[model samples]
Target chain A: MSGITRDTLMAFVDGHLDPTGRTEVEAFLAANPEVAAEVALLQRQNDAIRTLYAPAGAEPIPVRLSVDRIAHSGRRRNNRFLTQAAAAVVLVGVGLAGGWLLRGNADTPGIADRLIADAVSAHTVYVLEKRHAVEVGGDEEEHLSSWLSNRLQTNLAMPDLTASGLTFLGGRLLPAPDVPGGKAAQLMYEDANGERLTLYITPRPGIDAPRTELASLGADTALFWSDDMLTCTITAPYSADKLEAIASAVFAQLNPSGDGYEI
Target chain B: MADILHEIEDAVPALRRYARALTRDVDRADDLVQDCLERAISRRRLFRPTGQVRPWLFTILVNLYRNSLRGQRRSGDTIDLSSIPEPAVPPAQPGHLALAELARAIDTLPPEQKEALLLVTLEGLAYKEAADILAIPLGTLMSRLGRARATLKTLTGAPAEPHLRTVK
Candidate 1:
């Protein structure tokens, strides 16, 4: 560090020198004329270069540089890789906070994604329970609906999926760590051959996400949609078409009077 | 998530300034900046949570510019320097160099040298940050800057004497 070299001088001229180093270089320049002139020449060059280009930094930035718009484009591109089947029905929900973190925004692993993952994890864990699959079995329909509705703080009426060739097995209250409510209601259903599906419902009070998207997570196909009051993730090992059909029915019974699930 | 976008937004103007100097053409410069923004935003998860965004963005822009140059050359595209009329400038005063001649001299430097020089001088980046963006060692960046300045001094017809003669 004691040696005075050309790089050191250049660093001094460019303000890259630290204080102690600057003093040493200053003393070195005082004892040297040619080296001092070279440093002055370098400083002049820097000034000329700034004069030629710094104005561009002050120019008004183009609208095309909008960060949100660019992030959206990335999400749109990200969606192309989502191999699952259902249409991305816009479910623009209550507030834009959690919902705004949806779709192609998956790469950053947002809160909504964590919710969907938690749904899938819960589904995988409980669907295998033999004697105690649900805390309050589906046998007590009125009790299950009332208890889960109270727990999730949402007006959740079990969808009458009996018309969809499935029986309402039961429902349970689960922890939804990523959502605002901190609780989710999971309803279990099974076809005649015992094919199981779980609907993970959480009251997204401020989640302005009004989107219906189908994503294939491992062996399960998850159809995620949210309206102003509630957000639901339907995860099943069924084909995409089968999930879409069940999702339509669930959406219908979930919100019969309000915003019809848009495709 | 919006925080990352905010950081990227803060870097846009500086990125455009660097691109403009590098390309010496407005449309091309803006095009480069646009490409840089799209790539940065689309893959922002790669951004470190506590890290600064300005150097990361410059790294992306420099890589894209290099790749574009490679693609253009593969197809035999060439830049016609003569058509880029040097901007009008007043005569050089005693110690001053002609600004237009200096600009042309800059245009004539090899891309690597020009990039190193401008990053330090024009963009005012610290040497380490400039080197990191260029993906080169600090010594290599210093050498490039040294050579670029010498070339500019010669091409601008600035007198070459009295340059670092005191030390052997």
Candidate 2:
């Protein structure tokens, strides 16, 4: 407190000073700003470390690190071990009555999961383009709509969402290997800020999974919905509520009959 | 308790960032985090004295990192220094050397000094808690921090405050 040493200067830099000590150091720095500049440099080094790595905190946590999932899996493992031990006891006592029932097959990959993954992968791939973003530009809306509709084997109309701040850029036909028809259409839209969103539409005639399911992948949020004729997935970097509102506008114009468009 | 698990979950991102900055390899940093999480979950029942999970989690992560370094030192596995890309320094910065140059300077610090510097500067840990995490005395922590700052100054070639001194 009384004597200013190298340690005191560092303590000041690290914010280790008590209030009175801080005042003392402040006075010292005010007089000897050469040393103050040194302190500032150390502080800048701290800023550099944070600048380099702090974004990792904002980046979405990978699915493996999900807290709820990890805890649930841990409990499931414990329950499985208990079940096996009970089966062992059953073999010792009840003579293998239901040992075969524990052998269920591995679950099949859900169709909605595949659709969302494909939609996001496709969105991630083509959204970065400056000139080649879409197969048909928005300048030729009638022809682009007909071409995509003809290719997708469904009646496809471009959803105009200018009121929602997203302008139609264009559409591109993409390979949707997960769907029965094996084809999908991507309609690109960009807001005034140049943030892009894509609507992935495929002919999912019979695939029904609650009509709407939302999933988060990295920085993108995907909302997938299906009607009796076509399945539409809207993927964007916007919030879930924003995307939902946009999707509502999209679905209303997408299906003329408008059966399942409100939700 | 589920609350404790939630707290540890909340700390995961910061832990990952700190680990990434320390190791500078994505896979290695994530593997370290996974191991740290698993150990904390298993041994948490033993350290629930005050329910202070943040420092405890940091303690486990720091120890695991040190042990890994010790093992790597014995094994003689080479880290290709050229592989770590330097961050781009935007030209509009006001008064500093290139930020990438500062990054490489930080990389050159001794392991102990680097740990002290990061825990204080990067992680914003209190000096006492940081010392506790490192299992070093408070004075030792200060010395390590002092040495780290000195080395960074030398490597960064920080410009002198000619104007301020002239005013003085």
Clashing residue pairs in candidate 2 are none
Docking class for candidate 1: acceptable
| Candidate 1: segments with Cα more than 4 A from true spot | A73-263, B46-50, B85-95, B162-168
lDDT of 2: 0.73
Residue A163, candidate 1: C-alpha displacement in angstroms:
31
RMSD, one per candidate, in order:
15.2, 21.4
TM-score of each: 0.56, 0.53
Off by over 4 Å in 2: A74-263, B49-51, B88-94, B159-168
Candidate 2, position B2, lDDT: 76
- CAPRI-style docking class of model 2 based on DockQ: incorrect
Which candidate has the highest TM-score of all?
1
Q: Which ten residues in a row have the lowest lDDT in candidate 2 chain A?
A: A96-105
The most accurate candidate by lDDT is: 1
Whole-model lDDT per candidate:
0.75, 0.73
> Residues B1-168, candidate 1, lDDT per residue (tens digit)?
578789889888888889988888888889888888876664453223245678888988998889878998899997777777564334354257667678888988989998899899988999999998899999999999989988887788767864463454
